[model samples]
Target: MFLAAMARPRYNSAGECTFDGKIGVWPYVEWVAAQKESKNRKRGTMELKPSTSVGKEKSREYLIKYVLPAIKEKWPEEDRWNTIFIQQDNAKTHVDVDDPYVLREARRGGWDIRMIFQPPNSPDTNGLDLGWFNSIQAMFQRKMPKDLPDIVKKVEESLEEYPHQRLNRIFLSHQACMREIIKHKGSIHYALPHLKKQSLEATGDLAIRLDIDLEYVEAARVFLATP
Candidate 1:
């Protein structure tokens, strides 16, 4: 599987995109040189092989080596010193937020990077899982990748080519989903909301965040307070 990190796209004062929000996407594979010549290839040809082990060690390695550095390099300079939260689902392979090595690496360069999990049992709250992955997958499938290396290359291309504005729209949709979750008393059974985002964008009325009714906030508070 490919691992990815992204954030809501950022725009400057004149509304030009400053950051595209694609920290990076990394495939969980390594190149292994063939030991013996085969009909398909000569000996010593390096071939892409999917990782056999994907546990906490591998996950932490990806975060420390790839994700963190990408964020450091690509994150906006103005906000680099501010707290940056890396959100991941509560998969068993995911490192704990407080893993010592992770904490040390996250604290490097005086950047306040931190890790957090998505809301429990609410995978839809993640912008990637909510919409961006689907967008990337759609684009990647259109490329008709023919092999493992091709798949990786196509996926990375898809991610790079994906529009930043569409990504921002997906993040807004994520906020809308969170609002719905609160309105539904933390339930995930509700239908996904549609905002006609493309039309809204054309009209220049697309919102960075959806407004929530005060009553909904109160109701969610009450629900949280209940036994």
Candidate 2:
């Protein structure tokens, strides 16, 4: 999305926030603004944190604080029986799974929180890269954000408005893609399979977890062992 450091929300022609208006500014952790605001928010506002760059340092802050907490709260209880692996793209900005702060905080609640890096060159396996961005882009384009706060607010709203069922289907698609990649010896050159997920979901026949074929797993393991 909008990762620029500064954006001006529309104001009167004179450009003053005469109405106590909003501006689009990305402050770092409010890091320099530290200890001033609660962990939930920065020092002075009620909105969610301002939209910032998905940089390495920032990703660490968010993973430990924001994303982890949200997952803990909403994750299904049955799913908590084992370690929770939060897989993200291997972006340089994302923190390593063993970063001391990540390790320390991750263990605090007796939660086995961990990060997973996807295999490189396998964009087909990422649900976000596949279709979710299209959904987000469409939603974002529909909104006319006037300022930074409005922009952030609108983006958050769009995320909320995105269909959860669509996301579930994306996960299933990801699994399918992974299986395909394995069959191709990890090559990412195949077309993504269309599962008619929506139709299956509507008919109460869609499966949340797709079974991985043993051959694909064996194939992947064999390929990995070679190098």
**Quick one: best TM-score, which candidate?**
1
| Model 2: CA > 4 A from native | 1-54, 209-227
RMSD (Cα, Å) for all candidates, in order, is 6.5, 14.4
lDDT string for model 2 (77-154, tens) is 544545655555655766775788876876677777665666877776444555545755676687666765675666
- Candidate 2: Cα lDDT at 157: 55
What's the lDDT for residue 168 in model 1? 80
Best by lDDT: 1
Give the Cα lDDT of each candidate. Answer: 0.74, 0.51
Q: Give, for candidate 1, the lowest lDDT window spanning 10 residues.
A: 218-227
Ten residues in sequence with the least summed lDDT for candidate 2: 218-227
What lDDT is obtained when candidate 2 is compared to the true structure? 0.51
Tens-digit lDDT string for candidate 1 (1-227): 87887776777656788888777788989999999998999999999988888888998898899888888888888776677778777677888989999889989999888787777888677667766677666765676778998888877887788888887876767767877898899999899998899998999887643345532221111000000
How many residue pairs clash per model?
A: 0, 3
